[model samples]
Target: MLRVHSENELQLNADVLVIGGGPAAAWAAWAAASQGVKVIVVDKGFLGTSGAAAASGNGIMAPTPENWDKVLSERYCLGKNLANLRWLERVIEKTWLSLPLVEDWGYRFPKENGESVRQSYYGLEYMRVLRKTLLRLGVQILDQSPALELLLADDGSVAGARGVQRQKHCTYTVRASAVVMANGGCAFLSKALGCNTNTGDGLLMAVEAGGELSSMEASNHYAISTAFNATVTRGVPFGWASYTDEAGNDLGGYINGRRDPSFLPNALLKGSVYARLDRATPEVKAVIERSHFIAFLPYKKAGIDPYTERVPVTLVLEGTVRGTGGIRIVNDSCATKVPGLYAAGDAASREFLSGLASGGGGPNAAWAISTGQWAGVGAAAFAKSLGASAHERVVYPVGQAGLRSQSNTVETFDSEEIVRGVQAQMFPLEKNYWRCEQGLLDSLASLETLWQQVQANPKQDTVSDVEFSRRAAALTAVARWAYFSALHRTETRSEHIRVDYPETDPNQRYYQATGGLDKLWVRRDWIKDAMSGDKPQNVKVVTGAIDISGKDVGAQGIAPLPRLSGHAQLISGDV
Candidate 1:
């Protein structure tokens, strides 16, 4: 647990403390303040840009009734109904409402005849709407303030957070009755959170303070083009592909090497590729034949030649999806199992599937707005119930010593070098379209060794060097978790290809796992159980249950089985 300091240690008391300055944080702070609750928003970067949403070009995709129903059904079916249905419904319902709220705050959307036009499968226009809304709200925005730790009360409940304001060389703590962890997922915090940027800090804070996390193991993998190093470019929608030959011939056939175009229209539907392809048509077959179409099934999964042939083609980029399974929430009110804590946007989920629709004015941004607004209002109300005395207490600015501690302890490294290493490891041997148990094991071992070496010799100096160390730590954590998780799942599903376990077992049951649960013991059987699948006794229900006699589980019919255990705690070894 992070050490706590007195009120003199960090300054500023707020009714609601909102971490992150993304669309979610913006709405959260605005919503809380609108209720006349004192609020503060702390961000790791500049308010308008940075964070995951800033990197995202396309906004959330809104789901039509038919498409929405299909996506929801797919989530339930794939997740085996482990998902929280009410939360899903609430996200879908409030999406449209959130869009207009942002616009009313002064942001504009891409429109036709003054009405927003849907673009791509997920909406990409609501970004503008959010930007304008933030400016009008008068939120107390603190850019480039990355949170260091959760400040806990005497009883260990979450009170606020401690962080370093990089430019000031000082630590700042914003005390609050309730804190909303809208800081995007741990992708950036990979070193700290491990695998993906979800270091599970927010979840960890909630859990440490007696909150529970559900559906931690359900991550989504996106279909990125190998030839382009996954550089996403916008064009026509994903389902409607534009086929071209080396000579740039506009073949009279459709793009995307699938046998059915019907599923292409349903690309807007939120389901796995396997489910979408199951609804393919004969015309798609003709189109593939006519175009001499090469099947580019993103990275890894295409057979020998399909995997080897590095073809150049333009991607009709659709907006981004979580790719990781959606987070789990308990109710329509956006509350988690914990009382004073709330989560919104991608941070809270079991399904990991964001409820954004496919076209413009999509559901992604709308949900961020809606859920964030809800969390903010809820947090404010809860804070208010604590009475005016709570607000009377003064919050002190973080101490110089704490600031130095964070700056001196946090680590950062060469991100470019790490990215290159990750690409090389993922593409060639470990992530080959055809993965094998042996190859995966070998790759994981190598990654583990590398991580050990880095940890043993982690650079520690002054505050200025904190970022590098932090980054290095995050990268190692992410690599280790992803590699271990990939290695642990013995079956072939969705993006997890196992050459040895080539066929998807019809009766295999899937389970979801969360990390950092107190019930999980590092010294006892946790790690060993996870590696061997012994801990997931509850997952027997789905194993070997499906019938795949004549079905194509490889090319289609594959979905990611949940990892039934949480993350392994990091151990330090001397270099």
Candidate 2:
């Protein structure tokens, strides 16, 4: 068991600080430590057992040198020409190189026909190896320490971070030269396997620290899971499954050959939908069980064989955890607009690879490895330039809203109420999964009401309860950004479907960058214009405080975020 740091050691210094426990955080710590820099990784859970990847099976997207062109071409077309080709190429190359390092660390890949096949890996095994390797490389692992906010220097660059150690019931402050946000993405507390801790904590922290988010409209990704349980929703075994209505009638073209991802969600909206893997052959069934043992455990415990029995199914809203959207990175080094702050894995927007769509497993895994290394290298270089003087800079805690009451009224508010309110809007299939203008507007209104309450009263007096309070605020922030960006897009493209405007607009070939607290805003950056070095313009549609009318929610100004020193661009209106 990992022991908690001593009281005196709580407030410490490091060259690089990573805020996550998953593969991406481990890789970043490994990369930074390799450069002879002191690295510390703080996680919400145990290093090897946390995150979506640690609870399920995953595959990496690594193409051979000869197949690079063909793979990139297919992906480019699939992403509707919105992907950055160079970034995709780099991810492929870097991920291909990084996989061998895992094997060299003593993780033997399964062999077939006298050769090793390194396509997929079990979540537990992969994360355990990553944690072990990172520890061996002298990276400090601080488990059960969920970061609440980022510390910004007087010059507007990220200086360090502060969070509470859940087990110790004490606070921790790490003043580092650079910080990496690899803390995964929000799943709206959907109870997905390995995603309990992924509540957009880092996303909120980054945004509060004056970082911009991109492609958040593409965050409404849902996966098939057993209706009786919420933990096992990897969506792999469903490829061989057959779907049926409650009346036992075949729901043709639902799961097996379904092109539209929303087809099943639409069906479930009408009535209960059930699935069975009766179509899978014996060989395929064996493979499925072996690959997804955790997913089948629930079925076995319930005395049901999923391969033969009919089990009711529902769509699990993956949110941004499996979706493409997060803190927008400005360069290939995974550097965000804020200096000394980097984002990797699900914590960062994946639009450079998947555009307005989710890359599912393979691409996401490869992205984690590739981007993690780049961020680590970038952070190490920045720290080196700052040298020993890094700690001398005066820094301020930028946490607000959830940490303290934003209003003087101090209305009693429960964190659970905020979570339920956010989930009610995001989890329902009719609202977020298949969105229209009216539904979105209504949802936003309700969410804004909840957000106002959270800002007024977080209802946390103890350190351990701060995690829940922060989670509520983070989820609300993520939901608002997603909906605001969705409303701005107005056209159906990739995962962002607008029912009112049900056609992909050829002219609207742009990415939406969104961020703001009290007043949300979305900016449109045309693909061609961006390639031509043209500046993106904030859409004039809804600007200046999306006035929360008719609600008693008082006017709460945006939190005083650290003013950037002309090095970073503000996404929300002028500072």
Best-fitting candidate, measured by TM-score?
2
The stretch of ten residues in a row with the least summed lDDT in candidate 2 is: 543-552
Superpose all Cα atoms of candidate 2 onto the true structure and report the RMSD in Å to 1 decimal. 7.4
Off by over 4 Å in 1: 1-10, 63-85, 110-132, 135-138, 186-321, 325-328, 336-339, 350-367, 388-429, 432-464, 483-511, 517-575
Candidate 2 wrongly placed segments (more than 4 Å): 1-9, 254-259, 529-575
Clashes of each: 76, 0
Which tens-of-lDDT digit does each residue in 294-332 have in candidate 2?
878889889998878999999898899889999988776
Point out the worst 10-residue segment of candidate 1 by lDDT: 521-530
Give the per-residue lDDT of model 1 (tens digit) for 251-363: 33334754342222233232212111222356764543232222333323534232223234321221112323222344444665455567776555423232111211234
TM-score of each: 0.62, 0.90
Judge candidate 1 at residue 175 and give its lDDT. 79
